[model samples]
Target: MNVARLMFFAFMAMSVSSVSFAQDADCEAVAGQRGECAEEAMKAAARVLNDRYEALIDRAGSRYIFQYQSRHEEHKAFLDRLKNSQRAWIMLRDSNCRLEGFENEWDKPSYSADLNRCTAKMSLERALYLDGILPAH
Candidate 1:
C-alpha cells in the first residue's frame, strides 16, 4: 500500500483500540452506569468536536489572506476539501457505530449505550487529532 494509505489505516487501528480501552475504563469508573455516562460523554465530545472544527475552518480562511493575497482559489479548495472530509468522517463514524451496535440486540439498551460510547470515543479522538494539526493564530 501507499504510505498515506498505510498511515491512515495505522491511525485508525490505534483510534479503535484506544476507544475500546476508554470505553472499558469509563464503564468501570461509572460502576455499571454506562448508558447515562456514555450519553453524557457523547454530548460533551460532540461539543468539543464542533468547536474544534469551526475554529479550524476559521483558521483556514484567514491563513491565506495576508501572506497569499492571490490564492483565493487555493483557500476555497482547501475549505471545500476540509468540509467534505468532515462530512465523510461523520458518516463513517455513524455507520461504524451502527455496525458495532449490531453485536447486541437492536432493541436493547446495551446497543444504544455501545453506540453512544463509540461515538463519544471517536469524536474525542478526532478532536485531539484536529488539535494536533490546527494552525496557531
Candidate 2:
C-alpha cells in the first residue's frame, strides 16, 4: 500500500469510471473544429488542475503549521513526496495520452486534437481526485 501503488489504483479506477463519450458544451459547439476546441479544453483543465494542486499544498502547509509544528522534518518529507508524486503523475498522463493519440498514426490531422482531448480529460480527472483529498475548510 505504498503511495505510488495507491495512486496507480486510484487513477485506474477513475479512468474506468470515466468512459463516457459525451463531449462538453464547449467542445460540442466546435465539433467541426476539434483542434481549437480541444486545445482550449486542455488549457482550461490545466488551470483547474493547477488551482486544485495549489489549494492542496496550502491545506497541507496549514495543517503542518497548526498540527505538525514540532515535526518539521516530517512535513518537509511529505512535501517532497508530494512533489515527486505529482511529477510522476504528469509524466504518466502525458505518456498515456501520446500513446492514445498516436495509436493509429502519428501524422494524422486529428492527432493533435486527440492528444489534447486526452490530456484535458485526464487533467480534469486528476483535479477531481485532488479535490477529494484534504477536506475543505
Candidate 3:
C-alpha cells in the first residue's frame, strides 16, 4: 500500500511538473518574438501580441459569464460583479507591468520590452484562467 501511494504521488508530481514546463515554454515562445521583431518598423510586435492575448482573455471571460448567466439566471448580479472584478484586475495588471518596465530606469526600449513581456505573460495567465472557467462546448 505504501509503495502504491508513493508511486501515485510521484506520477502526480511529474504530471504537475510537466504541465508547468509546458506553460513556461509557451511563455518563452511568446517572449522570444522580441528577437524576430527587433527591427525598427516591427518593434512593437510584443505589444501587439500582448493586446491580442488580452482580447482573447476578454472574449473567454465573456463566454464564461454568458454560460454562468445561462445556468444561473437567478444570479444575474454575478455578471456585474465579474465585470467589475475583471476591470479591477486589468487596472492592477497594467500598474504591475508599468512597475516592471521601470526596473531599468534609463533605457526606454528596454523598458518597453520588459513592459510588453510582462503584459504578455499576465494576459496569457488571465486567458488561461478564463478558458478554464468557460463551459465546455
Candidate 4:
C-alpha cells in the first residue's frame, strides 16, 4: 500500500510539473497571437475609417465645388484633426506593444502577461478612436 501511495504521489508531481511547463508554452503562444490580433484589428479600423473619412471629404468637396456655404466646416475640420490623432495613436500603440513584449527580464509568464495586456489595450484604443469619430454607430 505504501509503495502504491508513493507511486501515486510521484505521478501527481510529474503531472503538475508538465502542466506548469505547458502553461508557460501556451502563454507564449497566446501572447504572439494576441499581438497579431491587435495589429490586424487596428489595420481594419484604419481602413474603414479611411473610407468613411473620404466619403465625408468627398461630400465636402462636392459642397465646395457647388459653392455651397459650408455650415459644417467646423465638423469637417474636427474630423481632420481626429484622423491625424488616430495616426499618432497607432504609432504610440505599436511602440508600447514592443516595449511590453520585450520586457522579459526573467523569461517568465509575467512578462508575457504584460505583452498580452499591451496588445489588448492597443486594440481597444483603435475602437475608442473610431468611436470618437463616428459616435457609436
- Top candidate when judged by lDDT against the true structure: 1
Candidate with top TM-score is 2
lDDT of 1 by residue, 9-128 (tens): 578557646765776687779877878888887887798789878887777767766556757888888888888888999999999999888988557889998898889878877876
Writing each residue's lDDT as its tens digit, candidate 3 over 1-137 gives 36755565566456444544554465466675653333321223334434545554455556545655544443345456656867887899889988987876498767765665566556545544443332234
* lDDT of candidate 4 over 46-113, digit per residue (tens): 55446645665555555544445564775567567766876787688768867776857376555555
Worst 10 residues of 1 by lDDT: 128-137
Per-residue lDDT of model 2, residues 1-137, tens digit only? 56775776677556534532434565777768867878877887788889989988877777776765756676787789889989999999999998998764557658888888889888888877776666444
For candidate 1, what is the TM-score?
A: 0.73
Which pairs of residues clash in candidate 1, taking residues 3 or more apart in a chain or in different chains?
A: none
TM-score of each: 0.73, 0.76, 0.49, 0.39
Model 1 Cα shift for residue 20 (angstroms): 9.5
Sum up the clashes in candidate 4.
Answer: 0
Global lDDT of each candidate: 0.78, 0.76, 0.54, 0.53
